[model samples]
Target: MHLYFLMIFFAALPAWFLSTLEGWITVDCTRAAVSSPMECTVGERFAFSSRNTRYATWKARSASLHRHDRRGSSVSYQLVLSTASGEVPVLRSSTGSDKIERIARDLNAAIGAGSTRFSAEAPPDSLFWFASFLVFLFAGVGALIALVGKRSGKS
Candidate 1:
């Protein structure tokens, strides 16, 4: 009976983890004063405009939330220039103000305006520990269920 119940409870695990993921970000994001929310990944490429001046993109090489949704909480990307034709590289510059740095500064200002900054932060490992605990709990329950089944059969 208990083992069966344990198996069913596993179904709720996803919801639990999702809540935890949001809460985890909420605490840290608030600390950093970032805007409402933006999906971010460590290595994935992301694009955004700063101070409404220019658009930039950054690649996320690291991620910590453990799961990938259609998007993440917040991410960073470098700037890329596109042309009217939208063909190959119309123009490109890296991390400098001429275009990229100016944009970055504008964005940084807007974000910093309300004590919030647009930056990508990786999730910590506590999330994984919860997952591991859930797995182990179920394994123990399964073993218990088998033990009971064997004993009842003998009786």
Candidate 2:
């Protein structure tokens, strides 16, 4: 019935969210000159100290997302680290066209959060998950209503 279909649809939403969660972008922290390796997320700023004598410490001010298309056949996503001094080439990864675009868009928004100019906003993970949970909860409510209706002999 419609309620059953709704339940299935709602159940799949969280799975979809989980599958798309940061799997598209593969960050390579190995090339970094840092003393200790570190992992980074999209909406965060990371800082680390270099192993080299010079350029002791560095902070990643923002992330620049790029999409390069080669020969109109291949495409790649590159995440460049922006520091106080200049830009540094960092992570290079591949993903689906749609997913890469979404990641780039979100990265830009996170980088532009504090600027005075207008910027697009990406929804926080907490808010997105909460909303997904509500939909799942409502699907259960719908199933209960359907059961009640069936028991009461009303179509």
Candidate 3:
């Protein structure tokens, strides 16, 4: 009896781990300040004009949030942009947690953001398919084990 359970558990172990593959969680960016959500990826060059500049360019990287003080609830976000010399903080905005999160999400979606301390890298469709295949394979193996166990008992 114990042997049967062990066989089943081992067969399903890979599937169990693969099943944890999660999809991208959608966020509400309705309140974001961007004129429109533009698709972006890391290291991509984007052009935007501020009042003082006519032709300004920036390389998209990622955004991060920070707190003003330990006792303060005020939150701010800074867009870490890459320039010819090095990375620099090009933009900063003070907002609440929810709005800050939305801004981060917008930057990520626009620039194909990478994994950060607070968020994860988006999983590809192939990963989900591979995980599904493993699940089916384990199910078949478990069924075969059940059949063999039954036959041996009958004999």
Candidate 4:
């Protein structure tokens, strides 16, 4: 029983870590801000930190939907901002492309000086997906262990 509990706790660890990344992005004509749990990661606390609060214009760009053929047919969509420096990813979704596109449209429209662009390049989302996979794997293993332990104890 104790081992089962320990495994369950370990499984929840990844989910807890991922939860830290959950936050909101607020964008307006004046500024764009990213707020996450404790603002621990880069670009999490503030999207436009001391560099420049105001942008001349905001352009919305989407990378081609990536179909991970090897990863159980998972498809991911990314939305990014095209800045003078480079493209900054704002949102990533694995559920649907339409929602992300609509969000990009809204964001660009909100900024007033907005444009839309689609690119063949995909945004870097390997880290996010890797973390997500870890969470899933850990949780699944934990559950399996718990189940097996329970059965063995009964036997």
Clashes of each: 22, 0, 3, 0
Better of 1 and 2 by TM-score: 2
* Order of candidate numbers by TM-score, starting with the best: 4, 3, 2, 1
Each model's C-alpha lDDT?
A: 0.35, 0.40, 0.41, 0.47
Candidate 1 stretches with Cα past 4 Å from truth are: 1-41, 44-123
TM-score of each: 0.28, 0.33, 0.36, 0.40
**Model 4: CA > 4 A from native:** 1-57, 68-74, 91-97, 113-155
Instruction: Give one digit per residue, the lDDT tens place, for model 4 in 5-115.
Output: 656676677766555442233333433332111111112221112112333334665465656665566555555666666666654233233345655666555445322
Clashing pairs in 4: none
Ranking by lDDT: 4, 3, 2, 1
What TM-score does prediction 4 earn? Answer: 0.40
lDDT of 3 by residue, 1-155 (tens): 65567456755766665545432322211222343333222221111111111111123344545556668754333434444556654332221223334534554564343322122222223554666667667767777777778889998
RMSD vs true structure, all candidates: 15.1, 12.2, 16.0, 10.2
Q: Residue 40 of model 1: what lDDT?
A: 20
Answer with 2 or 3, whichever has the higher lDDT.
3
Clashes of 2: 0
Model 1 is weakest, by summed lDDT over 10 consecutive residues, at 22-31
- Best model number under TM-score: 4
The regions of model 3 sitting more than 4 angstroms off are 1-8, 32-124
